[model samples]
Target: MDQEKVNEFLGRFVADLAATEAAGSVVIGQRLGLYRALAEGPATPEEFAERTGCHRRYLTEWLRGQAAGGYVAYEPKTGRFSLTEEQAYCLADPNGPNLPAAFLIALGMLRAEPRITEAFRTGEGFGWHEHHEDVFVGCDAFFRPGYAAELIPHWIPALDGVDEKLTAGGRVADLGCGLGSSSLLLAEAYPRVTVAGSDYHADSIALARKKAAEAGLSDRVSFEVATAQTFTGTGYDLVTMFDCLHDMGDPLAAARRVREALAPDGTWLLVEPNASDTVEENFNPVGRLYYSGSTFLCVPNALSQPGGYALGAQAGEAAMRELIAEAGFSRFRRAAETPFNVVYEVRL
Candidate 1:
């Protein structure tokens, strides 16, 4: 190999390594509320520590590392650190993109790297319930902001006539609901519709029930511990699966169940990761991130179940359309899309 080319590759490798190592620091910063404190105002490490009741030396090191990572701004003239508007939005604002929660999910799944590695050798499967608790919490936190921003205002309205039906006190079934974030959003937005949220994970279902009670929506919103294919519900005006269909071992079965659960004139809102029909078309940064998540999380969960099919996070629209059609759905159309997700309106 040419020495110059070797050095260039080494530079890229080191940058990637640095980013991987920084994931933990990002989680710690968020856990300790360092980013939020920094967003409040510029400060030296001592001042920040005083403001947040943290140790000064540790804060100093973290601040320096965060500055190196371009997550925060540093000033040599005054020896102070602060967050830029973009950084604060992503790292500090509770209603922002919640970038740290992504790191939390990554670290949580990586904690089971040994088990995942063994599963690779033995062809055994790793279920989502077997992963760290952070995986559950982080998954909810990471996706909630986007759902809050888009689900009510855009995704629901994108479905033809579904919003009006919901407004008129219709019923909804949210499969693979996970912590009920999407279900809660639906109930909150429409106020008249009742939502039934289901997940296979008992813990998730329990927490979802608790959240519904806390939101004072327990009267209309309910949760059950059930898989997508086994959820007990029928005659739903709208059925929804949010960023979850690909994780099922038998998504085709789930699709059929959704078809059965829907009312004659109902709509099925299926949301999935945005991907291309061609694999090569997904070689960019977003695809890279999704592929990594699929490898450790989505694929393993699907493998752990009964069916052998593991339609990964980047399974693409053509594959989804075929699966939905095979389940006896006559109409399928792209309803809406964000950079990270694609929404499909499916009808019987």
Candidate 2:
């Protein structure tokens, strides 16, 4: 290799090492509530410590790290730290849609590092049945209500003719339904449509049943313990999977199951974490972030090859279409696209 090129490579490697250590700063700041406190204006380190109930020395160290990582700004003369308007939007305001609750879910996965290690060694996920129970213990109250009250109302209508189609009773099933958020929303929206929420986790089914009852949709919506691989219930007009297909070990098998369960002309909807449009797109910063996050959380389940879980190659639209077709779907089209996800409607 050229000497100058070699030197540049080493320089980049050293910078990557530094970045890895700083990666946890965002999580730490969020857990400490420091970002929320500094949202309005700058504050002296001592004031920040008082506001967050932390020792001044510890606050100073944290602020220095955050500033160095570009998550916060610091003024040496004023001895103060502050969040920019962007930071305030993304991290501080609880009501703001920019808030990073996804990171909280990511951090929760980190707590399962030991399980991840075991899965890696055995080439199997910790098992979604057990994992879901641990993951959603306290998550339902926030996820179900938040998505229904905020995201669904705004976004679901964007699907072409979806609102009109949902007006009358239409059969809907939420595959890999966590706490029945999507199913409950559909149940609440269309009193006539029967919605079924299914997951491999027994605890999740129990919780989903409880929430559906509380939402007064017990009659219209039901919960069941089922895995995507073996899921079988036919004659459904629509089937939906939200933020879950990537986590399955056998997504194609699950997709096939969904196809078998659908009405002859049924629609199969999938919402998954965004991937790049091409291999070159993965070079971009945002794409890199998405890919890294999936590696740590989403794609590993596929790699593990457990029952019901199938390993999926990281891919974009073309790759997704191929998988859907392999699963026996006749046609596929993009129903919606967002910065964070891609929604597809496949026809049976």
Candidate 3:
């Protein structure tokens, strides 16, 4: 290779290593509650140790790692560590509006390391049905409410006149609904609409039911144990798959079934992590993050076989249109796009 190419390759290698090290900093800070402690003010390592009940030496090491990762500020003169206002909002306050909960959830999937290897080798997802509990339990509290109270409000209205489409008496099916947040939002928004939340995980279904009941939405919302590939409901005015399309083992089959479930004028909405337009572009940091993170859980099921879930990186907008057309949909349109997601509205 030319010297310029060699330099580019080496730079990427170093960046990858740095990213991996940064992941450790994230996990340790969260586990130690160091981010929360640093939210209020800069504290001497000794003061932080006293408050968090950890040895000063160990806490100092942890603080230094966070400082190196740019997640905290360290002052050598004062022997103190603190979170900047940005970090405080993003990491310190668990319930803060700017919390990085979704990013953390993706990171936690790294626990499925060995299983990721098996999936890569076999072209199948390993132990997803078995590890569903650990996966969801680690993320539900942070992600569920954030999706309901924040993301939905911002994205749902962006759909092409979706408010007028929903008109309060339509049937709405939430495919691969995790913890029922999106369904609950729809149910709460349109009191006359009946929302059905479906997932392959039984525990998730139970949790969804429990949450819907607790929210006094049980009358308008229901939960079911169903997989996207085999979902058989019909006459739905609208169907949504939120960040869950890429988790289906047979996305083509699921898409076909989704098409079948829609009324003649119904809408099928597919939402997933945004990927770039080419494989080379997929190697970018954001793409690498999504691709590597998916290996442990989503990508295996998504990219399991040909015609399965194609990463947007490898298959761009044109490919998505083709996939929808192949699934028997009459038309496909980019309904909306967000910072990290794209929403495609498919019509039957």
Return the top candidate by TM-score.
Answer: 1
Model 3 alpha-carbon miss at residue 163, Å: 0.7
Model 3, 1-348: lDDT tens digits are: 599999999998887777666766665666777778778689987899888888898887778877876878988898888988888977876556434455466565766677776766776645355554546754565555556654456666666656666864889899988778788888887777898889887887898899999999998898899888766579998898887766665677888888888888888877777776666877776676667656566666556444545443234576677777888888788777755567787787
**Residue 283 of model 1: what lDDT?**
97
Residue 39 displacement (Å), model 2: 2.3
- Alpha-carbon lDDT, every model: 0.94, 0.72, 0.73
Q: Which model, 1 or 2, shows the larger TM-score?
A: 1
Error of 1 at 234 (Å): 0.5
TM-score per candidate, chains pooled: 0.99, 0.77, 0.83
Off by over 4 Å in 3: 1-15, 94-107, 122-124, 132-134, 138-151, 302-314
Per-residue alpha-carbon lDDT of candidate 2 for residues 1-348, written as tens digits (9 for 90 to 100)? 699999999998887766666546665766677788888689888888778898898788878887886878888898888998887876777654433454455555566778777766776555444443324643453344445653356546655555566676788888888878778878777778898789887888888899888888898898888888776578888888877787777777788888889888677777765677568866776677666656556666566555454433246777688889888888788877766567787886
lDDT of 1 at 254: 93
lDDT of 1 at 288: 95
Residue 223 of model 3, lDDT score: 88
